[model samples]
Target: MNSFEKDWRFTRNSGKGFESAELDDSSWEKIDIPHDWAIAGPFSPDHDSEVIVDDPIEHTRKVFSHPGCTGGLPHVGKGFYRKHFELNLKPEQSARVEFDGIMSHAEVYCNGRYVGGRPYGYSSFALDLTPFVKNGTNLLAVSAENPPGASRWYPGAGIYRHARLIVAGRIHIAYCGIRVRTEGNRVTVRTEIENPSARKVVLTTRLIDPDGNEIASCQTSGDRLFHCEFIPDEVRRWQPGNPVLYKIVSILGDERHETGFGFRDLTFDSRKGFFINGIPMKFQGVCLHHDLGLAGAAVDRDITRHRLNQLASIGCNAIRTAHNPPDPELLDLCDELGFLVICEAFDEWKRPKTPRGYNLLFEEWSERDLRDMIRRDANHPSVIMWSIGNEIPEQYYPEGPEMTRRLCGICHEEDPSRPVTAGLNNVDDSITGGLFDAIDVKGFNYKPYIYARYHAAFPDAPIYSSESASTVSSRGEYSDRLFEESGRKDNLQVDSFDLCCADSATIPDHEFKGQDDNPFVMGEFVWTGFDYLGEPTPYHREWVRSSFFGIFDLCGIPKDRAWLYRSRWSKQPTLHLMPHWNWQGFEGKEIPVQCYSSFKTVELFVNGISMGSRTRNPKKLLGAYRHVWSRVPYSPGELKAVALDEKGKALAETSVFTAGAPEQLQIDCERCGNMVFAVVSVTDRNGNLCPHASERIDIESNGKILAVDAGDPGSAKPFPLPYVNAFHGKCAAWIRNPGKTLILAKAVLNGKTVQTEITAEA
Candidate 1:
C-alpha cells in the first residue's frame, strides 16, 4: 500500500472536463489528502441555503433560511481533485485505490475514463484502476460534490480522509478480506482470495503476540476460502481499561495483508447492563462527530489521538460515531487507546430528512454501504456493536419495520459475532411498529426519562442510553440565570453554567441520575464530546455557526462540565470548581458557586475565610456528588476548594484568584510528530489567564501554517493567515514541520511578543 496523499491539484465551486488527463491544471490550488475545501470559510449568511432542522423552541417543525445548521459556509458545491503518479505495473499485477471517506457523491476517473462511483460519502470504498490505467504515467481524478441541504450538520467537502493505492498480483487477497474472530482461547482466521486460474494458492497465517513473538502458525491451500484455527498457549484479552492487541499476517504468493485484532468477550444483558470479559461495567461514552475541530472532517491520526487522550482522561470509555460512519483512522485510534465504539452506518435510511440527504440514493446504495461498513470494520475488537441508523424518521413510516428488519438481517449476515442496534428517538413508535424487535440491543436517544418505565415494561430487553445529555455551554462565560431555556439571544456565547440545555434534551446532571436510578440500565453517551462545526441549537443566526453541546469547546479545551463526569465516572481523586473569580461587575455581591468532587466532603474558602463545609447529599438533584455554595460573597481576592476524605484528610485542593488587567501573551506548544499546535493565551501581569479576554493576536511560525483558529465558528477568518483573535482567552495555531530541528512560534499582543520553541520529537 502506498500513500496517495500529496501533490493534488484542486479546483472548487466551478469546473468542467478537469478529469481528463490532457487538461491543464497548473492554475488549480495545490493541496494534500485529508483536506476539506469548506474549512477555510469566509462565513456569511449570503452563503445560506434553506435546510429543515429540528427546532424545539418553535414548538413545531419548521423550515427557514438557517445557514447555521451547516456552519454558514460555502460548502454545497463541486470539489474536483487530480493527481499524477508513476506506476509501472506488470501484466500479472492489478491495482486499486481505496478511499477512507469522501464527503458526498464521489466519482473517480483513471486517465479520463470513468471507473467507479459511490453516492454515500461516509462509507469507505475502493475503485479498480487496473483497466483504465497506462503503463508509466497516470492521472487519477476525483469529483466529489456536496449537494445543497444534503446534511443536517457541516458535512465537509472533498476527499477529507486518508487515501491509499494498493497493487497486488492477479492471485491476491481481496481488500479487507481477512476476518478474525475469537471464542474463548481459540482464534478463527478466515481469508478470502481471488484466484483467476482456479489455482490452489498457498496461504500462510501467522499469529504474532504483543511482544513481537510468533505464537501460532498455520498453513493452508485453497482457491476461494482459507480457514484455520489456533488455540494459543495463553490469550491476552482486550479490555477498555487495558487494551492489548495482537497482529495477524497472511500471505498469498507474493501478496501480504497485516491486521491487528484483540481477544475479548463482551455482551449486553437485560438483567445486568453491559459486561466486558465477564465483568459488568457502565459504558461512559460520548457521541462524536467526524470533524476534528480545526481539521474539519479531514482526519489526522496525531490530532485525533490527542482528542481521544483528552476524552479518556475525563473517564470516557466508549464512543458512538454519531449519525454517520466515522473515519477509519478514528476506529484505529480507539483500538490502540482502549475505547469501546459503536460503528454507526447512516442518519437516514429511505426517508429524506434534509432535501438532498442520503435518502436520495438509499434505495440503490443502502445495503451495499451497510455491508461494506460491516465487512471493512468487523475485525476491530473495539467495535463491539453495529449501529444501523440514528433517529431515522422511518420509525414512523409504514415500511419502517421492513427496512429495519432488512438492515438488521444484513448486519447479522455480514458479521454474526456482533450485536445490532439503532438510535431510536421515537421509542414508542419503534416498539409498536416491530422496529424494536429487530434490534438486538435497544438504543434510546435522549430518552432517559423512560429508562425505568421501559425496563418494567420489557424486562428482558437490553437497553442503553445511546444519546443522552445535550447540555450547552460556552467556556469562560458565566451567567446568573441557571437554566436559559432559549439560551442567550444577545451574544455569540452561551453561559458556562451548563444549564442552557435544549428542550428536547436534558442537562448532564439529570442524565447522571437517570443512569444511577436504574442499575439495570446500560450507560449513557452524551450528545457530544466536543463542540462541532454546525447544528447550532437556539442560535439560528448566521453568527452562531457551531453547536455548544460539548463538554469541550471547538479548540479541544475542556469546559467546566468535564469535572462533572470525572467526579462520577472516574475512580481517580477529582475535585473541580467552576465560575472564575474575576466577575468584574459582581464584586461584593452574592455569586453562586459549584464544585464537582469525588471526595466525601468539600470546604470552600473566600478571601482566605472559610465559607462552610459540605458533604455529599445523595437525594439532591444536582448536589449528590456536585457540591454547590449558592450564596458565597464574591470579592477581588481568591476562592479555594479543598476536597477531604471521610476521615477529614485533605486529598486534593484547587483555587482561583482575581487576575489583574491584561498585560502579556503566553505561548504553549504541543507537538505530535511534525505537527505543532501552538496555543496562545491572554494573561495579566501575574501570568493569570483572563477568561473573558478576546484580544487581537498576530502569530507567526517558522513552519508552514496549516490552520489559525481561536475556535470562532462564526468568523470568516482565512485559515492560512497569521492573524486571529483569542476566543475565550486563547487561540490555537497548527503548523506543519518544515524539516527543522526546532520550530519557533511567536505571538504579538498589545506590542508585546511572546514566542515558544518546539523540538520535533520523532
Candidate 2:
C-alpha cells in the first residue's frame, strides 16, 4: 500500500479537460491530502446561498433559528485535485485507489478516464485503477463539490481524509473482507477473496495476544470464501478503562493481512443497563461532530486525540459520531483508547431537511454507504452499536416504521453481533407509530422527562439518552446583571454563570436527575462534548455562528460545566469553583457562587471570610450535585471553595482570583504536518488570561502566516491574515513551515512583543 497523500496540486476551479492526463497544473496550489480549503474561509454570509433567518417561535432539529447555521463558510463549491506517479506491475497484479472520505459528490479519474464515484461525502470508497493504468507515468484526478446548504453544520469541502493506492495480486484478499466474531469460547474468522483464476487458497490464521504471543493457529482451504475457527484456552475481554486487545494474522498466498480484535460478551437488559463481560455499567457517552475546531473537517491525528482525551479525562467512555460516519482513524484510536463507539451512518433518510440534503441521495446511496460503514468498522472491538439515523423527520411520517425496519434488517444482515439504534426525537409518536419496535435499542434524544413514562409503557424496550444536556456557555464569561449576560454587549461572549439550553433539550441537572433516578435507563450522551462551529442557539443571529453546547470550548478549553460533569461521572475527587471573581462595576453587588464537588459538603469563603457551608438537596433542581451560595457579596480579591466529607474535614480545595489588566501575551503551539498553529492569549501580571482583553495582536512570523482565528465563529475578517484582535483574550495563527529551520513567531501587544520558535525537520 502506497500513501497518495503528498505531492498533490489543488484548485477551486471547474472546467473540462482539467482532468486530462497531459494538462499543465503547475499554477494550482501545492497541497497534501487530508485538506479542507473551506476552513480558510471568508465566512461570508453574502455567499450565494439562501440564508435562513432567525425564527423566534419554533426550535427544531438541525433547524436553528438563523440562516447562518452552516457556519457561513465557503463550503458550497467545486474543487479539483491532481497527482502524478510512475507504476510498473505484472500482468497478474492489479491496482486500486482508496479514498478515506470526501466532502460531497466526488468523481475520480485515472489517466483522463472516469473510474467510479460515491455521492455520500462521509463514506470511505475504493475505485479500480487497473483499467486505466499505464506501465510508466500516470495521472490521477478528482473533483469534489459541496452543494449549497447541503448540511446543517460545517461539512468541509475537498478531500478531508487520507487517500491511498493499493496494489495486490489476482489472488489477494478483498477490501475489508476479513471478519472476526466471538461466541462463547470459540472465535470465527471469515475471509473473502478475489481470485480470477479460481485458485484453491490456503488460509492460515494466527491469534496473538496484546503481549504479542501467538496463542492459537488454524488453517482452511477453499476456492471461495474461507472460514477458520479457534477456541483459545484463555479469553481476554475488552471493556472501557481496560481494553485488552489481541491481533489476528491471516496469510493467503503472498498476501498477509493482520487485524486487531478483542473478545467481549455484551448484552443489554431493560432493568439493568448494559452488561459487558458480565459486569453491568452505564454509558457516559458524548456526541461528537467530525470537525476539529480550527482544523475544520480535515482529520488531524493529534487534535483528534487531544479532544478525545479531554472527554476521557472527565469520565466519558463512549462516543456517538453525531449525524454521520467518522474517519477510520477515529475508530482505530477508539480501539486503542478503550472508548465504546456508536458508528452512525446518516443524518436524514427520505425526508428533506435542507435544500440539497442527503434525502435526495438516500435511495441510491444509503444501503451501500451503510454496508461499507459496517464492513470497515465491524472488526473494531470498541464499536458496540450502529446508529442508523439521527433525529430524522421520517419519525413523524406514516411510512417511518417501515423504513426503520428496512434499515434494521440491513444492519442485522451485515453484522448481527452488535445491536442497531437510532436517535429518536419524538418518542411518543415513534412508540405509537411502531417506529420504536422496528429497531433493537431505542435512543432517546433530549427528552429526559419521558424516561420513566416510556420505560413504564414499553417495559421490555432498552433505552438510553442519545442526546441531552445542551446547556450553553462561553468560557471565562460572567456578569452579575442578567442584561449584560447576553452575547451582544460582551464580544459575542455568552454568560457562563447563567446556563441556558434549547427548547427540545434540557440542562445537565435535568438529564443528571433523570439518569440518576432511573436505574434501568442507560446513561446519556450529552448533545456535544465540545463546542462546534455553527448552530449558535439563543444568539442565532447572522453574525453569531458556533454553538455553545460543549463542556469544552472550540479550542478544547474546559468550561465551568466540565467541573459539574467531573464531579458526577468521575471516581477521583474533584472540587471546582465557577465564575471568576472579577466584578469591577458590580462591587458590593450580590454574586451567586457555585461549586461542583464529589464530597458531601463544601464551605464557601470570600476575601478570607467564611460565607457558609452547603450541601446538595437531591429533591431540588440542580441542587442534587451543585453547591451554591447565591447571596454572597462581591468584593474583588479571592473566592474559594473547600470540599468537606461527612466528618467536616476539608478533603479538597479550589480558588478563583480576580484578574488584573492584560500585560503580556502567552503563546502555545501544535504542529499538524507542515502547518503549525500558534495559540495566543493575553495574560495579566499574575499570568492569568484576562477574559475581557480584546487587544489587537500583531504577529510577525519567519514562516508564512496562513490564517488567523480566535475561535469566534461570527468574525468574518478573512482567515488568511497575520494580525487579529484577541477574542476572549485568545486567538491563533496557522503558520506554514517554508523549510527545515527555526520558525519564530512574535506577537506584539501595546508595543510589547513576545516570541516563540520551532524547528521544522527536513
Candidate 3:
C-alpha cells in the first residue's frame, strides 16, 4: 500500500472570513464544486449601486461607448464555498492537495499548517500537506479573496474550478503524461510514472483504442523512475478534418487514470505550408480567451462545448487558448471534439502584474503550477503547442529575452514532447537579437507580413502568426500600423518617434469588412469566438456584455461577419444579403421588388412586375443585384428577391424593403470575380450606402448541398463553393466548378427555352 494514502483528508471549506482566520464547516457555504459566483444569482439591476446606476437607456448608451466600466453590475466579493469527501489511506500512504483552478488568489490550510497560497487566476497549482493532514475528522480550510483592483472584465472570485485531495502510495503513478513518437507508419509510446515513495512498485501502462479496446500494455517498477513503451501496427493520426485519438491509461493497483493522445507528427515546410502526419494542411484556427461568455471564470463543460460547436459551424479547425491556460475541461472538449489547440500559460512575462504578475518565480509554487498544467493536459491530442506567454514585455523590459528564455526552458523541462512558444507583438526585436532562439517555435501576435522576414533571419526556426487578426477593422486600425510600420523600419534602427506615431495612429474600426487582402499569412484567429463579458469598451456604457471583436454575440448569435466567414471558409452552397433602410431623400415611393430564386438562377421583381433574372457566379459562387421603380409606383412597399436553380426551382427569398420617393439603388462590389454581387445603396437626393434609408440586395443560387467546414476565418482559404445562404432557407443546391469548365450555352425565360452551342471541358 502507498504511504501517502494515510495522510489524505477530503473536506469542504467555507471560503468566507479573513485570510488569517480558520474556516469551519459551519461558516462554509454549501455550494457545488464547479460554481461561478458572478453568475450565481439573478442579474439584479439593483446591484448597480456599487458602480454607476442611472437611467437604463443612459447606462446602456454609456456602457457601450466607454472603457474601464462594463455597464453590467459588478460582482459582489466575499463569497464562500464548501465540498465534502472521504479518504481511506494506508499506513505507508502520503497525501497531497490538488486543485484544477481557483480565481484571483487563495489561501489554503490543511488541518491548520497553512499548506500554501496561490495568486495566478488561470493556471492550476497543487500543495503537499502530508505532514499536517490527519487520517480522520480533518478540516480543510481555504480563504479566497478577490483582489482589490482585480480586472473589471468578469474575474469570478472564489474557487471557480475543481478541487481534489489525492491520497496515493508514495510509488503511485503521477498524473498521466503520455508521449507518442512516430516515424512514418511506425509509432512508439513512452509513458512516465513519478514515484515519490521510498519503496519500489510496479506500474502498468495500457493503450486504449477508440473502441474501448486495449491495443497494448506494458509494465515497469521503481519509486523515483518508471518507464514503459509500446508499438502499434495500426496507429491513428490526429488532424483538423480527421481527428483520431487513442486513450493512454496508466494503472497503479486500483487507482487508474486515463488521458487521450494523438500519435501524429506536425511540421511546417516554408514552401508548402503546414503538414500534419506528412499531409499538408492549412492552420484554419482562431484565438480564444479563457472566459466562457457571461459565465466568467467558472469552468462550464456544456458552454465550452457550445462555443466549440459554434466555432466548428463556421469552419474553424484550430484554437489558440489566448494568453493563459484555459480550464482543463476546455482541453478535454477540444480533444473530444477534434479541434487543434495551442495551450497557453500566462498573459504577461517574467512575473504576472501589479494586480498579480509573474511574481512567483523560482518558487516551489511556480514549479507546481507548471507541472500541474503540463501533467494534467499532456495527454490531450488537441494541444499542438504549449505557449509560455502572450505579448510579454517586448519593448519595456530590459530582461525580456532572459525572461523568455527562462519560461521556455521551464516549459521544455516540464513537457519536452510539445514545442514551446511565446506570443510576440514585436517581431523586429525577436528576429534581430536572436531572443526567439530559446523557443522551439516562434509565434508573432499581430504581424502578417513578417513571414519571409522571420524565415530569412532564422532559416531553421518554425514560426506562425500566433495571433493574426481576422480583419484589420476587427482589430481596429493600429493593428495594421503595427504590422506595416514595423516592417518598413530598418532592423537595426530603434526610433521611438516612429514607433509612438505608429502605435497612436492604428485604431480598430468596429465596422465589418470581408476578408483582409493577405494570403501569404498562414492563418488568423479573429480576436475572439464569443462575446466575453467584463471587457469594457469606451463605446458601450454598461459593462459591455461581450468583447466587440467576437464574431458571435454573448448569446451565441452569429454576427454579419460570421456569415461572411462561413461564406469564405466552407465549401457549402450559400446566399447572403444585407437590407438597407433609412436613406436620406427617398421617402414616399412604392418600389415593390422581390428577389426570387430557384436552384441556379435568381429572379427579381419590382412592383409585382418581373424585372430580370441573373445566373449564379460559378467561380466566386456569390451574386448580388438591384431593381428600382419611379414615382408612378406607390411610396413605401415591399421589395423582395428570390433565388432558384437551373430547373427554375425556388431556392430562397429575401426580406421586404419599403422604398420611399425616387431613390437611386447604388451597387458596390468589394471584390470582382465570377460571383455576381452588388451592395444595394438606396439614396434619396444623394447616393451613399445609407444606414437608415437603404435596402439590401437579395441573392439566389443553385448547385449542390454543402456541409459546414470548421477552420480559421482570417487565413482560411476561400471554399470552392460558398456555404452560407442568408435568405433564411434551409436547403439550397450548389454547383461545384473550380474554374471555367462549361462554355456559356443559352438563356431560358418563362416557358421559352433558348439554346446555343456550348463546349464542356475539364
Candidate 4:
C-alpha cells in the first residue's frame, strides 16, 4: 500500500480497454492516490458551463451568473487510477478492498475481471478481491466519473480519502461491524463476522483502556453474529470537554483486529434541552464542509487535527457535517478531541437542488447509501445523531411524510443506539406538520420564527437548530451601516466585525434571544464554522466565488464575529478589540468601538487615555453580548479594552495597534511525520499581523510542495506551486518530507528574501 500510494498511473481521458489486464498504461502520468484531478486543473470561467434545459433532469436545478460561474472549480469529468501490488495469500484466505470515499461514481477492476462499484461519494463501500486476484503481482484499476452540475458546491474528483486492503481467514470480523454501549459499569458489544464457509466459530473480544489495562473479556460462538457482555470495576463516561476512549480487539479463528470505542448516553427532551450522562448541556455547534481550503478533499491527519484545534479554541463543542457525510478521519478526530457530531447522509432526496444531483439516482441507490453510512460510522463514539437529509424539498410534497418515515426507519434499523433526524426548512406549519412523527428529533433550518408554533403543535417532539445564522462579512473590511442587503457585484462585504444578512427574513441579533428564552429549543448549529470552497452567498458577478458565512475566514483566522461566540460559549475570561486602530479617512470623527466580552464591565481606552466604561445591558443585545462605545474618537495609535468582574477586579485585557506598512515575512511551520504545513503571514516591523497587506510573494523551497493555498475560493491561481498572492495578508503551503534532517523555506516579498528552517526527525 505504501508503494502504491507513492506512484500511480493516472489518465483523465477514458477509453474502452483502460480497465483490461493487458492494456498499456505506460504513457499515463505518475501521480499520488489521494489526489483530486479536478482541483489540480487549468481553472477558468469556461469550466462552469452547465446549462439547464427544459428536460426533466435539467429543469430542476438553478442557473448562475457569478464570476466562478457557480461550478467552483474544473472537476466535472472522468478519470482513472491504476496501481500494481503484490498479494501473497493462501487459497483459503480472503482479500478485500475498502474505500473511505470516492467522488461521484466509481468502478473497480482487479487483474482483468470487473468488481463491484459504488455510486454515491459520501457513502463508504467495499469490494471483494479474492476471486480476481493472483498469488503474486496484480493490477488494480479504478475509474471515477463526476459529471458537471451534480452538486451545489465543489465536490473533488477521484479517490479523495484513505484506501486499504484487508486479508484474513475465511471467517473474520467484518469492517466496521462492532457496536459498543455502556450502562453504568456494564459494557455490551455486538460483533458481526462473515462466514462464507457456513461454519461456526468461537470469537473472543477484549476491552483495553488507554492505560493498557484490560477491564473486561468475553467469548461467544456464532457463524455470523454474536453478542458479548461484561462488567468493569470503574467506568469513565465520555462527555463534552472530556473524551475517554477504549480499544476493542476481536479474535475470530486466529484473525486479529482492533477499533476505538467509547461509552456515553445522549438524550433529549422538549422541556429540558439536551442531556449527556444525565447532565443538561447546550450544543455549541458549527456546520462544516468537507474541503480543507487549498488542500481540496484529500484527508490529511494533521490538517484535520489543526482545523479541529482551531474550532475548539473558539469554544465550539459540536460539529454538524453540513448536507453530507464527512471523511472518516474527521469523525476519528471528533472522538479524540471531545466534539459531538451529527453525521448527515445526503443533501438532496428525490428533489434536485442542481441540474443533475442525487435525486436523479435516489430511488435506485438511496437505501444502499444510507445503510452503508450507518454501518461504516456506527462505532464512533462522537456520533450522537444520524441526520437523514438536509432541507429536502420533499417536505412540502404529498409523499414527503412517507419518504421521511422510510429513511428514518432504515437508519433506526441499521443502528438504534443513536436517534435519527432531518433538517426541515419549510416555514409553513401545515406542510411540515407530519414530519415530526417520522423523526425522533426535529431539526429546523433557518426557520427560527416558527419555534413557538411548532412546539405547541407537537408537545413531545425534541427540537434542534440544524442550521442557523447566515451572516455575511469579509475579513478586515468595515462599513458603518448596521445592516446591508446590497451584497451585489462590485460591493465587497463589510468589515469582519460588521455582520449583514441577505434579507429581512432573519435578524441574527434576535435569534439568540429566542433560543435562550425557549427551553424547547435545545441548541443551534451556525450556518458555518469556517468559510468553505463553494456556494458563494450574497453572491454577485464581481465578487469572489466562495462563501462569506463563516465565523472564521478560510485561512482559519478568526473574524471579529468569532469573539461574539467565544464571549458566550467559552468559560475562560475573554476580552477582544476589533477593527485595528487604522482608519485614515475617519481619524477624528466619532468611530464605533465595540468589545465582545463575558465580563460585566468593560473599559475602553485610546492611546493611554480612558474614554469611558460601560456594563453589559441584556435588553440592548438580541443575539450575542457585546459592549459598544458608539462614539469614540479614532486616532492612529493603540486601542485597548479591559474586562472586569462584578467585584471590579480585572479579568482580562486586550489591545490592538495601528500596523505599519508590511515589512517582514513570517513563517510558522508544524511538522507531523513527513508532512509540513507552513503558514505564511505578512507582518509589520513590530511583528503584528498586517491584515490589509496583499503582497505577491514568491516561495522557493528545498523540498516537495504538496499544495499552496490562500483560502480564497474565487482565486483561479494554480496550487501545488511556488508562488501565490496572499489573500487578506495570509496564505498556507503544505510540504511533504521537506528533508530527512532539515527543511528550508525561503519567501521573497517586496524584493527581500527571508529564509527559515525546521529541524526534522524520522
Candidate 5:
C-alpha cells in the first residue's frame, strides 16, 4: 500500500498533452500527494468578503456562512499531478489505482489514455488499471479542477489525500466486502469474493480476539458470496467507553484478508435516548470538519489521533463528521479509543447550498458516493449512526420525502446494522411531511427550542441535536460589545469569561438542562469542538484565518468553555474558575463571578474572605441554572472555589489569582513514535498561566518541524510557521522525528526573555 504523499510532479497551469507519457515535465515543481496548493499562497482578504450596508441581514454571499471563512486562501482553479512508476507485473495478477480523496473535478489518465473521472471530490473511488498497464514504465496523470465558488469552504485544491496502486489476483477477496455482526455468543461473518476467473475455491475463516488468541474457526465454499457463523463460549461487548474489537481473517487458498469487528448490541428509544450493550449513555459529542490546520486536507494518522485525543481528554464521548465521510483511519482510531461515531455522507442533496456545490453532480454521483462511504466504514464498531445529509435544503422541496426515503434505503441496503439520520434545520417540514418517518432517529441542527414541543407531539421518535450551540469566541480576547456586519471593530474581540453567542446566551447550560428535563432527548453534538479553517462569520476581518466556534481553539488547546463542559460531562469532581483577577479598572469593585462544577454546591473566597456558598437554582432558567456567585468584591489577589457534594463534604477546590508579569516558559510534550506535539505556554513568576499574554514565541527543535498551531483564529499569521504568537498564553508545535529529540521555545516580553526545553521519549 502507498499513500503517494511525496515525490510527485505538479503544475497549477493547464497544458496540452500534459497527461502524455512522453511529455517533458521537468518545469513542474515537486510536491506531496496530500498537499493543498492554495493554503501555501499569501493570505487574501477581498477574495471571500461581502459588501456591508446599513443592515447586516442584507449581506451578500450569505451561503459563505456554511464553512466559516476559507482562511482567505485560494481553493479553486485546476492543478495536475503525475506519478511515474515501474513495476514488473505477474501474468495472473491484476492492477488498479485507488484514490482515497481528491478535491472537486478530477480526471485520471494512464499512459496518455483516459481511465476515469470523479466529479465529487470527497468520494473515494478506484479504477481498473489492467487494461491500461504496459507492465514496465507507467505514467499516471491526474488533473483536479475546483472552480472558484465551487465549494462552501476551503475545500483545498490538488490531490489532497492518499493514492495507491493495488496488485492482486483476479480471484481474491473484494475490497471492503467483509461484514460482521454479533448476536448472543455467535458471530456472523459474511464475505463477498470476486471470482471473475470462473473458478470455484474453498474459503476458511477464523476469529481472533484482542489477546491474539484464535477462539473459533469455520469453512465455506466461495461462489462470489460466502457466510459462516462462529459461537464462542463468552463475548466481550463493545461500548462507548470500552471498545473491545475482534479480528476476522478470511483465507481462500493462497489469498488472505483480515478485518476488525466489534460485538455490540444497540437500541434506542425516546425515553432512554441511546443504549449500547444495554447500558444507557449520553453522547457528549462534537462536530468535526475534515481539515487539519497546516496539514490541509491530507489525513495524517498521527495528527488525526492528536485531534481526537484532545477532544477525548475534554470528555468528548462521540464525534459527528460535520458534512462528509472522514478518513478511514479516523474510524479505526475511534474503534480503539472507544468513541461513538456518526459517519456523515454529504453536506447538500438535490438542492445546491452554493451556486456550484455537490448538488450539481448529485444526479450521477450521490449513490456511488454514499455506497462507498457506507461500505468503507461499516465494519468499525465506533460507528453508531450513518448520517445521510446535513442541513439539506432539499428536505423542504416537493420531492423531499421520496429523496429522503431513497437515501435511507441505500444506507439500509449497504449496512443494516446502523440506523440512518440527517441534520435537519427545517424541523416542521421533516416531521409533518413524513420525511422524518424514513429515518430511525431525527437530528435537529439548531432547534433545541423546539425539542420539547416536538417530543410532546411525537414522543416515540428518538431525537438528538445533530448540531447545536454555535458559540463564537476568540481565545483570550475579551469584549463587552457585540458584532454586526457594520459594527465597530472592537466588537470582534471575544471575552473568555463571557463566552456566549447572541443566538443563545447560556449555551451548553441551556441545552444541557433541556436534555435533563426531556429524557427523550438523546443529547447533542455541538457545532464544533475545535475552531477550524474558513467560515469566519462574526469575525470576518481581512487577516482572520479560522472560524472561532470551537470549545477548543485551532491548535487543540481548550478554551474557557472547555472547563464548563468538563464540569458538566466529566465524572470526576470538576471545579474551574475563569477571568484572571488582574483587572486594572475593576479594582475593589464587585465583579460578577461564575463557576462550573458537577458538585451540588460551591463556596467562593476572595483574598481569604469567605464570599458565601451558592447552589444551582431549582428552576431551569438560563441564568439561574449556571452556577453564579453574584457580586464578589474583587482585589488584586486570590479567588478560589471549593466544590461540595450533596452531603456538604468538600469534593474538589481550584483557585485563580492575580498573576505577575510573564517571566517563565513551559513546554509539555506528548509523544507517540516519531510524532510529537509540544504545548508551549507562557506563565508568570509563580508558574501561573498568563491568560491574556499574546507574546510572539520562536520555536526550535531537533526534529523535522511539521507545523505550529496556536489555535488563534483572529491572528494574521498562517498556521505553517516555525514560531507562533501565543493565544491565551498557549500554543503548540507538531514535530516528526525518531529516537531522542529535544525542542526549545523562547519568547520575549517587556524586556524579559524566557526559554523552555521539552524532551520527547524515544
Candidate 6:
C-alpha cells in the first residue's frame, strides 16, 4: 500500500477529526486541486492586463484591487476542499501527505487536528499523518482564504499545484541528494540519503548511460548514509550547444527512483566568463514566469512543451525560471529537451507578510521559504543556479549584503552543486559590490551600464546582465528609451556598448549593433518568452495587454519583437511580411501596396494575382518596402498575400482582405461629450480607400450649449467639447442638429447621423 493508504483514514467531513470546528460550508465551493480560484470568482475586468500608470502609489492601489493581488489562501470569499481515503496501515508502513503547492496561504487539517499552514505559494510541504489516520476512513479538510495582500500579478489560488499521498517503508530513503564534482577524468559523486526510519536497509545505486547501459553501480548497506563514486574512460560533458545527460537510478528493495545527471565541471573565471564542462559557454537564455497566458494557473504540459519548442526554435538554449520555482513538468521537459535551467526561489527578499493592509517582508519566513525551495528542487540536473530572489526592494533593507549572504549560505548548504544568485535591480556600485561576496554570479537587471564598474571591482567574478531588453524593461515599466539615454550620456563615465555587450571579439563571430551587448557580456535572459494573464488595469485591457513583456501574444502569435530576437539569435534566413492592411482589400486588379519580408527571395501575389518577385538583393529583399504596381486581378473579393520558401512551400499567408464599398459608420453620444466613431472603413471594391467623401457632424442636447468644431474627414473624431456628461444621464449627437428642443442631433463620422429624443426634467 502507498503511504497515504497506510496511514490515513477515509472520512466524509473535511473538518472532522481536526482540532477546530468544521468550517462553514454555506459559502464553500467544492473544487479540485490545481485549480485557479480567480477564474471561478467575479474579479473586476481591470484584472486582465498590464498597468501603464507612472505613479507608484496609484499602481499599488490598482494592484490590490485585482484578484491576482489577493493573498492568503484561495479566499475569493471562502472555499473548502475535502477528501476521504481508505487506508490500511501495516505495522511497518509509513505515510505522509504532500502538497506540491498552494497559493499564498493554506490551512490543512487531517482528520480534524490542524496539521499545518503554508504561506509561501510555490514551495511544497508535507505532513506525516501516520499518527492521526485510522484504518477505515480518513477525512482531510483544507480551508483556503484569498487575502488582499497578493501582488497584482496573477497568483492563481486554491491548490493550484499537485497533491500526492506518499507511502514508504519504515527504513525507506526519505530524501536523497547527489552532488557531482569533476576534476579532469576523476569525477566525485557525493550522495546524501536521509533515512528517517529507525531500521537499517540496503540501497543500491547505479549510474546509467544515455542508452540505458549501466556505467557504474555500487551497493551500500545503511539507511542513513550512502556514498558512491564512478570513473569512466570517456566522460560526456553537458553544455548549451551539446547537452548530454546521464541517468542515476537508486533502488531500495522494490521501490526505485531515477534522476538525470550531467558530468560537467563548471567554473566562474573573471577573465574567461562562465565555463561548463571545462569549456566557456555563454548562457543564451530567457526569463520565464510561471503563469501561461489566458490558461491561468493550470499546468498544461503540452502548452509548456510548445512554448519551450518555440524558445528552442529561436535559439534559446537556456531558461531562467524567474522569481520562483516552476512546475515540475517544466524541469522534466528541460531534462528531456536538453535546456539549461536556473531554478529560482522567491520574488521578494523576505517572506511576504500582510500587516495593516500592506504586504510586508517577514525575514524568518524568507529563510524558511528558501530552505524549502532548495530542499525541494535540488535534484534536477538541468538546474545550474539557485536564484534566491528577484528585484527585491534594496532600500527597505540597507544591510542587503548580509541578507543576500545568508540566503546564499542556505542554498549552498542545501545543494552546493548549483551556484547561488539573485536578480539585482539596483546596479549601484555599493549594491552590486555588496552582493558580490554573496552571489556566485553578478546578475544585473536592465543595468548594462554597471558591468564595467563591477568587472573593474572584481575582475575574476563571473558577470552577466541577468536581465536585458532592447525595447522595454521587465515589469513593463521602462522602455528602450531609458537604455539609449543612459548609453548616450557619457555622464555615467563608462563605455555603454563595451559594458553591455553579452559577447566579445574573442567569442564566435556575431553582429555588433551600437549598444548591443549580448553573449559577450556572458548572456541575457529576455524579460519573458510568452504573454501571461492577470494584472489587469483599465489602461491595459481592451487591447493586447497582459504584461506586454513577452515576445509572443496570449494566442501564441509572435509579436514584432519576437522577430527581432529571431534575427539576432537564430540568424537564419527568414521572411516576415506585414502589409499596410490586412486581408481586406482585393478586387479584380492588384492594388498598390507595401510588403515587409526578411527573405533572400521574395514574391508578392494577391490571391494568386502575381505582382512582381524579387531575388536576393541583400538590402532590398530583406527590408520593408512600399511599391505601386498592377498585376493579375481577382474577382471583387478578399485578398491575401502569400510567401513561399525556395521549395515553393507556402511559409505564411495574411488574413483575407475584403473588396467592396466600406460599410457606413455608426456613432454614439452622451451629454458631457459629443462622440463620433466608425465601425468599418469605406473602401473600394479592390479594398483601397474610397476617394471624395465628406460628412457633417452636429451635437444637440437638452443641456446648455457646449462649444463645437468639425473634425477632419479623414479622422474618426468625437463631437467638439461635451460628448458624454461626466456626471449625468445619456445625451446625443447627430450628423446635423434639427433645432428641436426635444430632439438632439449630431453629425458623426462615416457619414452617419445620431438623433436622440429626450424628455427634460420639469
Best by TM-score: 1
lDDT digits (tens) for residues 662-700 of candidate 3:
244333321112221112233333433223321222222
Q: Which lDDT tens digits does candidate 6 get at residues 1-762?
A: 123322222212344333333544344444445666554323343333223323332343343222222211123433456666778888877777887777756788777778887776777788777777888877776656555444545566666677787677655555435555545555555555556654667778888887889978888776576777778889777666666778778788766877776666677666666777777766767888786544457555555776787788777778998768788778878877778888887776543322211124345477777777766665565778888777766524567778788888888887776778777766564354576567887677766655666677667677775666623212111111113222222111111111122211110112212113333367677766764543221222222124444665443444544555564567564444322232233433333333334444456665566666654432331231212232334444334555667886777655444323432322233221121211112333354533222333334455443223221111112223433321001122222122323334343424444333343222
lDDT of each: 0.83, 0.81, 0.51, 0.77, 0.78, 0.53
**TM-score for each prediction?**
0.96, 0.93, 0.67, 0.93, 0.94, 0.67
Error of 6 at 228 (Å): 1.4
TM-score of 2: 0.93
**Candidate 3, which segments miss by more than 4 Å at Cα?**
1-28, 40-80, 92-95, 150-152, 176-197, 350-368, 395-397, 436-440, 449-463, 470-520, 538-545, 579-762
Q: What is the per-residue lDDT of model 2 for residues 1-94, given as tens digits with 9 covering 90 to 100?
A: 1356888999987478878977899999999888897888777654433445435424433443354577778888899999998899889898
